[model samples]
Target: MKTRKRLRSLGVNMIACLLSLIMLIPIVLILLNSFKTSQAASDMSLALPVGGLHFENYTLVIQKGKLGVTFFNSLLYSSGSVLLCVILSALAAYVLSRNRSRLHRFIYVFIVLGITMPINFVSLMKVMQLTLLQNTRIGIILLYTAIQLPFDVFLIYSFVGKIPRDIDEAAVIDGCTPLRLFYSVVLPLLKPVLVTVMVLTFLNTWNEFVLPLYFLGSSSMWPMTLAVYNFFGMYVTDWNLVSADIVLTVLPVVIVYLLGQKHIVAGMTAGAVKS
Candidate 1:
């Protein structure tokens, strides 16, 4: 039995390593090709650059891809959506978790059900147009917030449920207003989950491609994903430049994830087993 268990464990570890490599190989290829000459990158091989790195690929991509404007657009959309989603989801979750009323319960279920609901882009675009939000920056930000709210609410809802009510009661006894209670007392306690939400929302908004394609008609307002797509189309043969553009587009997301990864793990596992 001991030998069999050891074999099983080894097999599992081997499979896990293989899967990790499978996912990592493409990223490694992209990074390597981004530094190679256009001819060298055309094959998209596993081999490293033969000569010195072609650092000009990144500079050319930044210029030709108009990445400056797109980077700002992505940052705006992601930060705006993250702020809105975190604040709104936290407030909604806290209230619903604390109230436990029939209506609140129904509302919470309805919102959470959105997680599985498929978006009808045609109708969504029509709504955006009717609201005079099409092709607008704030409109796209709000769209991202709406898209992310369901999961954000669900995550924060579960976390809020884990927080003890005694703290809320004591704050009320101390003459804390509802806003003060939440901002000062509850919000501080929600740091782990809030950080998780911010990171997730930022990533989602930053990487979103389809919504901008449909709703944003102006190229100037395009985010990094759309910029990368357009850059790919314009420089289809320049694999090195395309790879560089892709790396630049994903760099911010990678940095953010690396910084907040610990918070993400802690938040996700905080109340998982109910102690």
Candidate 2:
């Protein structure tokens, strides 16, 4: 029995490693080809950089990609969405977790429905136009906030449910204000899940493409993803610069995930077993 279980575990581990490599190969190719010359990178070979590197690809991409401005815009959208989403989600989750009323249950169910529902882009665009928020950063941020709030609330609500009720009672008995109690006591315990939400939210907002293209009409307001289109003309595409742009664009997301990786498993599994 022990030998059988050990063999099964080894097989699973090998398969997982193989899958990881499969996922990572494309990223590795992009990084390698980014350093090659335009002609070399154009071939899109997955081989080593044998033809001496073209370091100018990075500089030219930085200039042509308008990376400075686009980076700021991306940061603004991602950070704004995350801040609003996290705060509102935290507040809503706290309320839902603490109050088991039918109203709270209904709200939670509504959020689940939101999760399952597809975004109505046309209606959202119309609403933005009416509010005079079309083609603006504020509009995009608000859209992101609304879209991300449901998932954030769900993750936090699950984590919050696992917290001991004794902590809430103790805080109340000590005359702690409800707001203060949540911030001081409950919020601290929610760090793992909060980090998870922030990482995932940041990634989604950073790499987002279609929404920004449709909503942000002006070239100056484009995010990194949209801004990369500058490297192409109607006739020719610069693969070298494009690859370099991709590397830079996803670097921050990769770094963030690496940093927060430990918290992800903790956060996801924390709410799995009821306390």
Question: Best candidate, lDDT-wise?
Answer: 1
Q: Model 1 segments beyond 4 Å from truth? A: 1-16, 265-275
Worst 10 residues of 2 by lDDT: 229-238
Per-residue accuracy of model 2 over 91-116 as CA lDDT, tens digit each:
99889878999999999879857777
lDDT per residue as tens, model 1, 1-275: 99999999999999999999999999999999999999999999999898898899999898899999999999999999999999999999999999988999999999999989999999998999999999999999998899889889988998898899999999999999999999999999998889999988888788889999999999999999999999899889999999999999999989988998887666556456665
Q: Estimated TM-score per prediction?
A: 0.92, 0.87
lDDT of each: 0.92, 0.84
True-structure RMSD for candidate 2: 3.3
For model 1, give the 10-residue run with minimal summed lDDT: 266-275
The TM-score of candidate 1 is 0.92
Candidate 2 clash pair list:
none
